[model samples]
Target: MEHHIYIIPISTEKLEMTEDNHSMTNEFILIGFTDHPDMKTLLFVVFFGIYLVTMVGNLGLVALIYMERRLQTPMYIFLGNLALMDSCCSSAITPKMLQNFFSEDRRISLYECMAQFYFLCLAETTDCFLLAAMAYDRYVAICRPLQYHTLMSKTLCIQMTTGAYIAGHLHSIVQVGLLLRLTFCRSHQINHFFCDVLPLYRLSCVDPYINELMILILSGFVQIFSVTVVLISYFYILFTIFTMKSKEGRGKGLSTCASHFLSVSIFYGSLLFMYIRPNSFNEDDKDIPVAIFYTLVIPLLNPFIYSLRNKEVINVIKKL
Candidate 1:
């Protein structure tokens, strides 16, 4: 009995030490796009060009709206903010991804990972609200033209913008806080290009039931609420446009909403696929491709989508 007691205590101490060692992991290796030498160079050049263009385009749009007095209405205000968030979303993922292309180590520290996800989440969440706001603005303009200025006032625009950021920050803080509770002691290698929440959950030694639940609950609520606002607003705008007596008026309203809805459909479609799903864990292969769309491609496309179809912005560019 005495010998057995000593053996059991010794085993317990060893087990504790092992757990300590596992929990002390401070960094992770990001297994990015490709390992082939030639492919790396090709991908690096392609993505570098993308990153440069994304920055220039988004920042240029923001600058244009800020400098132009004509573009001072609610529509442009929301558009400018959307461009800024797109830049942020690209910056959160692309730079590190580019570096990892040539880096042999491809290592990202745990805290660094947390920061990446926080900014990404903030930009994405803010974008959802911003799109919804833009939809409402369009509805007011097209559906209720007489009270457009009164309904979409400057004060209300600023308030909605502020509210979006507040919600984004709150969501990000809660997500990062939940991440801190997890001890990632299994595999140090993350499967995706960047340290996304889902991939990190797959690495956790602890069961991430609560983390997954929170992601579904929080992300679902944000997306659903924002999407609901957008849908309701657009429904009214559509009805108003069809009821217009003049053909020119109907065409003008359709043209205005077309560009906005195009951007919305692409952005929301990719996001809905990424987050609002039950089997995100098993869909590892699909994650990288879908993430590339929202994180890189959407930002690049938005500038062109909004600008090419906008006569006011085009005239402003021509004047400049």
Candidate 2:
């Protein structure tokens, strides 16, 4: 038998690095919509239009809320925060996605990918709790109109908003920290457009058991908690509305709740569909369109949903 020896060269820097450390040189190839190369231009145009509309609509809403004195109520305050978060959430992913459409190099560095993932998570998590807060606000306003001012005071509103932001940061920190521990040795092609949690975890060479569990438990808790609050609030609101003797009062109350319910339904529906399941569901490319709807289309549609249904916003716009 002949003896064979194979010498594999290793860089000195790599040898010194620990298993937990990810190499800066590692790049992820986002194979986003590349299979439909023929539709690249069309997709670009469509997403670009969506991005433009999202920016103008969200920022415009924020500005309108700020400039108009009558719009400075607690409800409008929450609306402004939602607009800001929506703008940030869409911005964190859309610009890079648009660039990927035209660029031959779809490679994203490890740091950039992580940064994108972090901000996206922050905005999303914050929005979850923010929606809950908004629901609670509505509950107080509708169910206990006399006590609404006392229950949702300026101080309480600020505290709730602060808590939402803090919760978002903490959630992202834990998630991103877990993700950084895993090493990626397999192919770098991320099937999705952006650096989503499931796609990144699937690409890891390790078992990713802990990461997946954390996602399931933490994300499920947030989703369930938020949805519970919204449901409970709406239940009380509907009860209170029906008890009212005046038809005009009932119609007005329903009108307000309808817009909020619509917004909440659209947002939470897309989110749950994308994230409520295991990583096995991520393998399907069909999820990409759903992800786009969650991240981009929802943000774009939010302004229209709220503004079209809201006479206050319309009055403000007319005054401008």
The superposed Cα distance between candidate 1 and the true structure at residue 114, in angstroms, equals 0.2
lDDT of 1 by residue, 287-314 (tens): 8889999999999999999999999999
lDDT of 2 by residue, 220-313 (tens): 8988999999999999999999999999999999998888899899989888878875554446665788889889998899889999999889
Q: What lDDT is obtained when candidate 2 is compared to the true structure? A: 0.88
**Candidate 2 lDDT score at position 139:** 94
Relative to the unseen true structure, what is the C-alpha lDDT of residue 287 in candidate 1, on a scale of 0 to 100?
88
For model 2, give the 10-residue run with minimal summed lDDT. 18-27
For model 2, name the residue pairs that clash: none
Q: Candidate 1 at residue 221, lDDT?
A: 96
Worst 10 residues of 1 by lDDT: 1-10
Residue 160 C-alpha lDDT in model 1: 98
TM-score of each: 0.92, 0.91
lDDT of each: 0.92, 0.88
